[model samples]
Target: MPKGFQAMTPHAAPPISVEGLRRSFRGPDGRPFDAVAGLTFRIETPGTIVSLIGPDGAGKTTLLRLLAGILTPDAGEVRLFGRRPDTNDPEFVATLGFMPQRFGLYEELTVWENFKIFGALRGVEGAALETRFRDLMTLSGLKGFEEREAGKLSGGMKQKLGLSCALLSEPKLLLLDEPTVGVDPLSRRELWRILEAMRTRTGMTVLVSTAYLEEAARTDRTMLLSKGRLLAEDAPDALAQTTAGRGWRARALKDAEEARLARALMHDVRAASDSPAAAPWLDAVPHGEYVDLLTAADHTRSGTPPRLATDAPEAHLEPRAPTLEDAYCALTFPETRAVHAALAAPARRTDPPAPTRTAGNPLNAQDVQDAVVAEGISRRFGAFTAVADTSFRVRRGEIFGLLGPNGAGKTTTFRMLCGLLAPSGGRISVAGVDLRTARSAARAKVGYVAQKFSLYAQLSGRENLEYFGGCFGVSGRALRERIDELTAGGELARRLDARVGELPLGAKRELALACALIHRPEILFLDEATSGADVCARRAFWRRIVDLARAGTTVVVTTHFMEEAEYCDRFLIQDAGRVLALGTPLEVRRRAGAASVEEAFARIVTDARRRNAEGFAS
Candidate 1:
């Protein structure tokens, strides 16, 4: 064990114990709704890792705040170390470290300065503080970058820095809320290693909430919540075993056909069942180039399983081991199916209106032309080159993806494409207007949704839509019509009048998309649109994007979730301002000699970095 954590020891009581907890908040309609309702659970072990998971609005955040003593429960009891928690108690506060979804780090300060300040505020100072800070920097891989400003750090580095600051006090109990939401896969692995190392060395307890089920499966225990109640709690492997012999993988499926196959399978299952109890499949969801199907117990026992109706000679089905995600879907499919049915209505615009040119732009709207063109584009700041000699073409109505690790210049390239930043060199044309000559006119033909929330928090959803519509030259009856078309009979329609600040994370994401689409531009850009969303929400969001692309809207997107890269017609991968690979998903995987996009991405980036280091040494 390291000397820094040697002073820590396991507590006598379990880390957390809750009994009949309940909390409520008023809705926009002025009615009370339970956020955390009548929940009971206990963590019986003192030095174990536990994962809390659920869909949006499942009260995961509320429950975490309650356990951390940041919020008071309206009904029952919450105990820490066998005693009720009091936030005002210094000793109690010293024993706990809570990193909320947004850690309050001083953006203007240097990384080292931020750590020193946080440590001193927690009563660690002088040489003792210096030793602890060095240990944390080494653990977080931020040792050589101490002078970097916090505001300028990459997404992964910022998250690592936040984790380091949270550990300065050496709290026995750590609460992390979605710590890896927007982080890259490599950084996520590093964060988990740090957590595991801490637990193994010092016997500290960790309670983390995550949107990624794969992360949850690594923990000692998993607790699944839904609508403020605990639906299931058990070891992940044991939970997965409950769905044994029912999981199947579909082979020989194509990207464009996967969605249609899933929908068809759902429809056939519903039609084949005369009664609710006669359904043959629980759910069918697209997983990359294949589908993951959860067969009904009775269907599997009867020696017959569902099959796809396709002419492909190699199409086949094979049994696969169940996973934590399979268990989660099995437990929640009935309720989720109903909610999805309600939300999927507005996104089913298969024959949407054709693209129209923005007023004052002379470009002809055609499906065959290249929607975005860049030739040897580069951007440099002071002595550093952010993007260098990059070139790509995006076909109209195509789904093009921009992919890279944090600080790899993907955002810089995206900003140049959007005409938000002028390139330092090279030629670029967007929507047939030369970006150098008419940046504003080119911007008028494209709609962009940023990586972070960019809407008015205090205004209602309808008001924000109205505000953005007017900015795009839409007005009065036309603006109202656009809003109606965007929200009619969908999830947004139900939350239309709610303040943007008060809605759930998924709802907020959808509203941002609506605001961006108000102008009906020829092209759309989405940056990490579903970074913090649950699996169901991501599927729904992609469905909308797919339909839009089918209806002649050119789409460019950037996401950290590698699985989402499969949805792109073609994608470009870059690192350190240079292109690594650019091709279809199949071509990229073949070039990298990997079976999946995630694996290909890792292999590509690792190989590039290794080659660069070797060249430098030579």
Candidate 2:
């Protein structure tokens, strides 16, 4: 142990206990909005990991702030270790570590400087501080980057530094808010490993909030929240059991066949009110070669809807085990199946046109021509090489994904492609136009959505969209027409006049996407566009993306969610500024000998590390 550390006595009180907690805020309409309304729960175990899982605007952040004593509750009571916590009480506050979503680290300061400042603020000094610093450096993989400025680090490294700063004092209770939101899978796994090790060694209680439901499985217990209320709290397995018998998988022989069957199934569900046989099924979504279906567990007994046509000749339906995400969807959105089908209905009807092929001319072959191409792309900053000889091609109307671990040069390559960063070496082309000659013209043909929210926070959503539209040369009646069309049916319509800063994370994401499409460019570039969106919002966003692709819009996107890669036609995986693997999702999985895309990514990265280590030894 470092210093001022005390082990919890065997009979010590629980780390946290809450009773009738309630918090409300005034909405844009001047009406009271309950962020955390009448919530009641307790953390009885010590040294265990607990996760708060929910959609955007679900009150997870509010509850965390309340527990940290940063915000006083409007009503009810909260006890930390059987005592009320006071923000002004230094001794009380020192017992906990709170890392909000936006950690306050000076951008100009080096990593070591930030750590030292945080340590001093926590009143830790001398050997105790040094010892803690060394431990954190090793655990967070930040030892070699201590001299680097905080702003220069990649997204993943920045998060690691933030976490290291938070753990400097070794508090008994650690509170983290969405620590893995924009982080890649490899970094996310490493962070979890560090957290698990810390929990086991120090017996510290951890409470984290996350948007990814799959992450909840790693926690000792998961609490489900919605609209500022606790819907359920239980172990991962227990929650999965709630939707056990309702899960089913349907497989077809080919992609075309699968698509046809999926459409048929959806049609059956939508017309179920008239057709009793289809009424039993709740939802169906395409999963590669197969379609996953969800139905009421006791539909047969309920008799309100007849059983599905599982024996259909076009496809094969088999009962499948429920996953944590499946259970979460069932519990949180009971109408998820219908909602997904409704959102996807448009894309199913108008599929994108297939790439045309030339019969005789090899130069004009469909496979040889591409909308975007990069050959021998590289970028250097003084002595450091940020990108190295990266090459890839994106065909017209293809959903091409760029994936990599943090600091792997994804952003650098993305910037070069978008003309924001001039490459040190390479040739680039967009929309058959050479970027070297007509970069401005090429940029004009594409739309870009940045990784972080970039719109003016003070402006209303409508004003922001209108401004972006005008910047894209869309003015007069045309600009107004575009804005009205974009926000007509979605969440943006409801909050058109609300300030961008006041919107929820998901709503803000929607607004950014809408702004990017104001001019209807031929190509779209998105960098983690769905980072903070909820499951429903992500589904809706993808539906629109598919529609755009079908209408001849080429899409180049980067994402941390492994499952989202399924939507891509092809993807490129990079590491250490070099391409590690490039192929379709299934091809990459086969090369890595893995079961899923996530597993395949881990295998490829592990192999890359081994090769790099051998090169260093040689």
Candidate 3:
């Protein structure tokens, strides 16, 4: 038996305990804010997997840091196995394994070298080190990539290597902070499998934080946090059952009216709340072909679906089995729920269309309607091909998705399309302008939001917006007008004067999108814009994107959330720098014979890997 499996078996005490935890940090405005306020929880069982979930700035990360002995709480106490967690205690440190949101690995080092270094730091060396490395590499599917440079590995591979390093010491307690963020669905499943297997073999306790509610629902226990307080904690099923009667699914008469219908439903719910005889608070969001509705528990409409006022095609409402997300919304404040639903509300019918080339144009396209076109595009760095012979076209006002597993060249391809990187071969055009000969002209018609926050952190949101608007040549009255248009009476308006870094995850995301739209460019590029946002924030973000596409702005986005792919009009899937699938979401689902995009994505990627190992042409 391996040392990791044997090392954690002798201990019998509970892995974690905390009471009245409190932590605070100074905001960008020089004001103190409680990050983890009066939180208390205990995990009594060994070998249990507990999921920590919350919206942005809900103190999930702060709680993890406090438990890891990296941060001292202003108040309250934490006990690991009935002893205080002290950073200077070697025994305590050795028994705990922590992987932060961004795992710190020497990017320039090879996978084997990185593993060896982390092992030595954790006191694992010689034969013991070799055995541990072999076991972890095999389990993580990284055995063959030992010689690969850590920097060159795909996102998924990097995550696996990080996990292996964290686990080198066979710790009894493992802490993973959003370990699966920004990776493909296939990689996410593999990571979870490794976690489950590790717990089974070693009886180690695991605490992980994630934005994916469905992922949290699968854990042995889930703790939902909001505003630095524990809102609810229980087994996943128990928590879900709390919202049993609040969930409903409503489908529009026409499938294409789903978004519009959802907007109308939410709008009616909000408006009714302000009237003399208003209905209870309700949340509505578009879900593929239908609109998902969750009503607050009200005896007036306890068992029957509430009627909503809307000009959209009549919708049929049916009861939906409640999930963890519905439960989360139920516990959240009414203001938060209102903000989410309100932001996603559709534009007023009296408003003018956004200024874009494709506005008022039909979906059907002739050759001249192509907003973006790439032919046999390829980018090679030295001997390695990042993107190979990729070809695709984006129609005007269309939402096109570029998807693939980590390190599969999605970024490279996206850069080529944006005229940020010169492809080694093939032709490309943006907004009818040739990228090869008129790169500057092509770039002028597009706006890009990077995967990471690229705006000035110290500057106020309003200042950042002004700066970006100036760069894009919108100034004086024009820039002010644009800022007002983006921030008028919503979440953005509330956070506009605050420093950008001080804003919560959702507000920061909104600011980023607001900056991207300041120029009203014909094309918008978003690279995982909603990667860490909560469910409500994601729904709000997509609603804005759908509205953009409707007004003739071409949107090219890359996201790891497979369900987000369903929002794309058309998308292409790539792996190992090769195009494996390309078509509408329904078409791809049919090809793989899978029920959901995530399932199809996993099946397709697994099949491709198997074929490659069998020496078949990819």
Best by TM-score: 3
Best by lDDT: 3
TM-score of 3: 0.89
Off by over 4 Å in 1: 1-12, 253-289, 295-303, 307-314, 334-339, 346-368, 472-482
Candidate 2: residue 141 Cα off by (Å)? 2.6
Error of 3 at 278 (Å): 6.1
Considering summed lDDT, which 10 consecutive residues are worst modelled in model 1? 343-352
Q: Which digits, one per residue and each the tens of the lDDT, describe model 2 over residues 10-71?
A: 78888999999999999766789999999999888777789898777889999999998888
Cand. 2 Cα-lDDT: 0.77
lDDT, candidate 3, equals 0.80
TM-score of each: 0.87, 0.87, 0.89
lDDT values for all models? 0.78, 0.77, 0.80
Please give the lDDT score for candidate 1. Answer: 0.78
Tell me which residue pairs clash in candidate 1: none
Candidate 3 C-alpha lDDT tens digits along 140-255? 99989999999988788889889889988889899999998988888888898888888878888899999898899989899988889888899988999998887888887764
